[model samples]
Target: MSAAPNLVNLETVSKAYPDQVILDAVSLGVSAGQRIGVVGRNGDGKSTLLKLIARTEEPDSGRVVRTGGTTVASLGQTDTLPDASTVRSALFGDADAHEWASSPRVREVLGGLFGGLDAPSLPDGLDSRIGVLSGGERRRVDLARVLVGSADGRPASVTEGADLLLLDEPTNHLDIEGIAWLAAYLNSTKSAIVVVTHDRWFLDELCDRIWDVQGGSVFEYDGGYSAYVLARAERERQAALAEEKRQNLMRKELAWLRRGPKARTSKAKFRVDAANELIANEPPPRDAAELVSFATARLGKTVFEAHDVTVKAGDQVLLEHLDWMLGPGKRVGLVGVNGAGKTSLLRTLADATEDRRPAAGRVKVGRTVKLAWLTQHMEDLDGSWRVLESIERVAKRVQWGRKEMTAGQLAERLGFVGGRQRTLVRDLSGGQRRRLQLARLLMAEPNVLFLDEPTNDLDIETLTQLEDLLDDWPGTMIVVSHDRYFTERVADETWALLGDKRLRMLPRGIEEYLERRAEAKSDSAAPAAARAKAPSQSTIDRATQKELSKLERRLEKVEDKIAAVHADMAEFATDPGKLTELQGRLGDLERERDEIEERWMDLAD
Candidate 1:
């Protein structure tokens, strides 16, 4: 019956940098339990907007209001964890183990992000030094630190979650499974979430509202990324129709004015104004399709052939006696859990250049294949060079649909517009540098492309553009990405390395791979004998049994509420305000259900 109070509010907020005006005269609010996804091109102020909400950054003009004593937790794109500090110290400071160790939520966070306390990646568990961890491991630690909320050395019951969570590219370095876990965790949180990420599937699944930041303003759209895209397309269609009518009217007006001197003098001023208004209101033409015709070297029938390829990492065999072939124009997507040797396989294929090597068996490569490997490492780039300069090193000019594009134009097409082309590579953001690399790679016109974690630092816009570019590529492509949507978009076939010393093909794509992983995990979780037997209830006390029964009833009620919420959401699909409210209610119900389940598990144990 009452409106939810705002946790943070921005009133006529204006922020600008020396070179760019990021946000101008923007007004927005974040209420309790709101999940907002911020999406735009790189350097489009999405992260800046989050900072303003968290009060970590001040606006150049106007005011940002926050509720009294509201606690905020934020994860920036860059990891700020001290390399010298242990994971436990970075996460909980000097807090005792009893504080968070006893917390089920904290344990869940650890398990979801880092594969539990005893994960191989964390060889020393909480005591592992941050400096020893790889990039992905460090990223997970940074995320887990924010996600565990605040323990304060208190008991789990006394711990409190943040009122608002601001996440910038939170899904970075996260595998598909990890992303799913995070989505579930965030959905079950009572805290409001404002996340800036390029993962479209993540946005569509978790966010109730979408914020499109562009041209120094924030445009709000109801529902998820799909809804936002549809709304935008409809708006463009309506504008096109209006422009057509205006064009016809302007033509008529001009014709009448040209009839005679009398006709010109009759309503000349009115005609002139009308024509001017129409001309001023005319919209610019839309950009052409991203990918254009590029001359690719002809590929022979034998693009790449693997004969009894057995690849290994140390003693861990990744591929065992595997025979495979990559034909000309074959597009493949490689996916597996972290540490599952996807990168190893990619390198093995790329390295089979000179001979059918004895070390890893035989892999025959076609002679005409010009291979381009876009690796995750940005170290390949010379930071001192400008964006355009780096691209020009590959080629000064490229063919685009019967037209030539200078290195600068090619850079702009890849998202380095005007002044950005002049910026030093070292000064560019992670995403900018990725785009620059892609531009350079495309300039080479390689017939075969090997992309490893290509979506690492790219925005959704850039990802979409890259997909468009790849759509028309007349070459063999092998992509390894954690972003599901991008992989599905670019690759025609999906393959998985499930850590079983095999490279398996999945006809149904990622869905099938996930099912197989789920089945394997389930099978490996317990022995057949244990799974066949039920836990005895004789150990439970009368009071505990009663509590368990009550929890079961509560869970049933919660399930009903969930079903009802889903129906309400579907019914109010056209009403954004009502849909947002319903989404919040659903999240609360889900959280309640999860708490009840956890309590039940505790009681049974």
Candidate 2:
């Protein structure tokens, strides 16, 4: 660790809103050159604590002290600039843009703050208007303002107004490349950084310290995410031990006090006081283990099939001449840039019927298929209704594990407790609304599910729980998500939404997908002269490419089957019936895998 001074310190800080106490006498400190990640459930005090550290908001009690000459910056949307404002105006505010852009130092710093940004031209550019930019572009502009300071020639150093960077959901609108660039930037910067994000990869790679905001306190763990997991488990074990000891002492004290306490004798009264104190101070019990699983019927061999499909929006063809099929136990992930029509394609597949063709395509849904599609807008839920009311509209009772559970019990397990059930959707936080939508979706028990950005506005705990739910879902799923980690964790492979109006499976995974995209971008950016001199790399015949793709997919699926058979055997080792069945299945899968391997080798030869 480098020798750096304390950047900011909090002393007995407490903050509360009308309905809840967020932070209670919580003290936290940040030092220079420290990269910290903040984690907690939704509606926890993570944001509130960040505000205190940035000095944007004061605590109800106690003081927030910062070192002399220290400066702070945070990526927040509360101060979004006017839509019609130009990029220069957005970043510089009331300062003169010409004065700042002319300075070589300021221009260099700005370029460093936002690398590879095709920002507005020097004097003026029409595309620089904030209203014309995409959501991701607007967020980048805000981030630039945070990092580069004002346009009036702010110093580009720790003495300037951006030494301590406090970011909330910084990676929300960023693509894979932007996220990678951000990770590199954070590691290279000397400023103390504290981030609140749901991106597991980001946290695991960048954070050296983790601060868990739970139970009105901040628990600090020194290390990355994996280290935090182990440390947290050990800490919980220790706490359980302490709680058990307390319970034993409390039980013995109660026995003594109850022996002969009819009269208020001095000895009896003292014992009674001790027992009452112990009862009052009993540690809270751990959360109940929540069981999440689908109660859907068995899926048929075929789920949905699209032939010669052309999925389009307006004049933009998202997919053309695409033939796709989904069978039982298929988990497909769709990835592309924004405005790539991912949700539109999902809607077409879900809404297809025998009477109506879907956007220049023929789609056939298999018999006994129960499908549910969750769009990003969550149009299925009414904004005017309360959480409980919305869920009740779906189902009042659900088959949960070994027993049937009422809506109320299910809601509590999904983290909707007490007044939360009565709270209207409009009044709930973004994460709360997402949970409500997901809870209702799961209640439907559809064997085929279509989801678009299901991880948006959700907490890490909820994400992990959803992953568990999908692992044993035993159904077909197609998910569209920008979360690299989520897709890698849940999907067997991803489908790249290519600009050539085709959806290609990427069995090599996210890294390969990113690499191909980078190569395409670089090739397109090359000068015209260079392109004319270069030989074409697309010399392979389409039929050969198609055949190779088929072999790759089949080989991967067979390998997956072999691994899964072993997993089942290990999981059900004690049951002889299951063991015998698994052994037979494993043998067949092995033979099938060998056959595919031979075919692949023959093709290669």
Candidate 3:
């Protein structure tokens, strides 16, 4: 294999703010085809590092070197598209249909993002005014323009195929399917990508490396998010051990550096060992079984129920005749397309509407259900108030399970430290404001939480803390979020709002939801002639069809069993012997499932 060429480099880069140092003498390089994920707490130089590399902002001391003619494209946290321009003009400038239509990459980008220029979501199609679009629509347009890289009507291959892509929160407004499509699209491209996002799943799916920015320095890691986490734990453990042995800070640092002769050679093995040791020594973040038991004791049986409920936004029926039951201590994650009414259902269940009315049916809440909604809007907050004041206004002390936390303690956990709690809400950044909102939400101590897009503007560290807090929360919770990692981490089961006015539980979770969406899109887009050429089910022998159905059922059972086995492995991760047993069982189950899948494919063909 050939080595990837370096595309960009930062030499001893140092950047700082008036109040704090952002980066200090950090050196890094971006090689061709390197997919890197940047992670840290908010305001910890993540965006600064991207800006320095992109040369949008100069480092105070060091230099950023880019290869000659290496075009760099970036999407900031906010939209930078001209509001006066139409989507067509914004994407391809004066290029006519013939110019862009000939480019397969352009077409794929269009199809994947905006549904091939003919989607209903674009009422005027490409001619839609940028100013008239919603925030999410605008975000998608900006992203498409950057990905297309065709303002001069040239093909993306000619303009951006091997260029450097610096995207900040590119997945902010994207749904799960959109995110999946983006990961696949970026992987297929030849460009070197450095993306700053809180989406852990995206990082794991796309990145070949990770950069952890903290305390004014960047610590490099070898692999994806999961690998970075493992390596980081090991690094911290080595630091801790050095401190313990030497009891001297500088000597401890030196000791850590000199501890391992083979560390440089066997880093991967070291990380694997670290994972095993950490799993065995550390307790699970939350006790799911205990939380459920506690929740049942507190909230009795029912949390919320909807019978024949219908919800509409203007003339569009978002949900229809939906019937759902929310049991005590259940945690559910709701997902769908951008406008698929996940939020509307949340509102209905929480009875947040002005008139307590659903378009068709009724909602019932149990007497013991104390619901608190963490909405998407930050307008509910008083900008004049300080962070601690805002939290204290809700309650000075909140009960989380059996433990009681003071306002300051809650603030600290949510990332607001000593002086930060005193900072006025008006002066806080977007991510800080979000943390404040969550702190306030928890102060209410509701047994039922309806969290709408709670992961927005939160960094990976804050997200980890939030997930940890939720683990101990003994409550019935419903969350609507685009962040797949957070959803899978916090919710026990997944459901989808498929625009059929029905809330469907996904037995196989979000992956099943993605598959259903893909199938729907494929069915809609199939050519009539292609559909007609396929053999009809009635033409097949009834017995063979039955056998195929039987095979499918068995395959599903085996796959579910495989998922169960994996979960069991996580539970027994601390025990080496038990993990080895589960690993063998998992291997056997996977082979059996693969055989069934192959048989089904052959029969179908």
Clash list (residue pairs), candidate 2: none
- Measured with C-alpha atoms, the lDDT of residue 574 in candidate 2 is 41
lDDT of 1 by residue, 354-404 (tens): 453524678888888888999877757777998888888989987643466
- Give the per-residue lDDT of model 2 (tens digit) for 1-605: 65789989999999999978889998888988888999988878888888888777899999999988777878774446578987766666556556466654445445543432324221123236777765766777777666665312342332244668888888877766567667766776667889998886677668888998887888998765544544554466468733543334334323322332221122121234544554454332211122112223365566788999887654335678879987766778888644455666676677673345666868887876778777677555667999998898999987644557678766766678788899888888877887888889878867778887888988776676566455545567888877776776667668887566787888776766778877876776576335323322445466755665566556555654554455455345346888778778878878987887676555544
**Considering lDDT, which of the candidate structures 1 and 3 is the better prediction for this target?**
3
lDDT per residue as tens, model 3, 15-121: 98898999999899999888999999888999888888877798999899998878777777787778898888887777677867777788888788876644224
Residue range with the least summed lDDT across 10 consecutive positions in model 1: 284-293
Local error of candidate 2 at residue 474 (angstroms):
2.5
Which number leads on lDDT?
3
The lDDT, on a scale of 0 to 1, for candidate 2 is: 0.67
Taking all chains together, the TM-score of candidate 2 against the true structure is 0.71
* Model 2: lDDT of residue 71: 74
User: What are the RMSD figures for all models against the true structure?
Assistant: 15.7, 17.8, 14.4
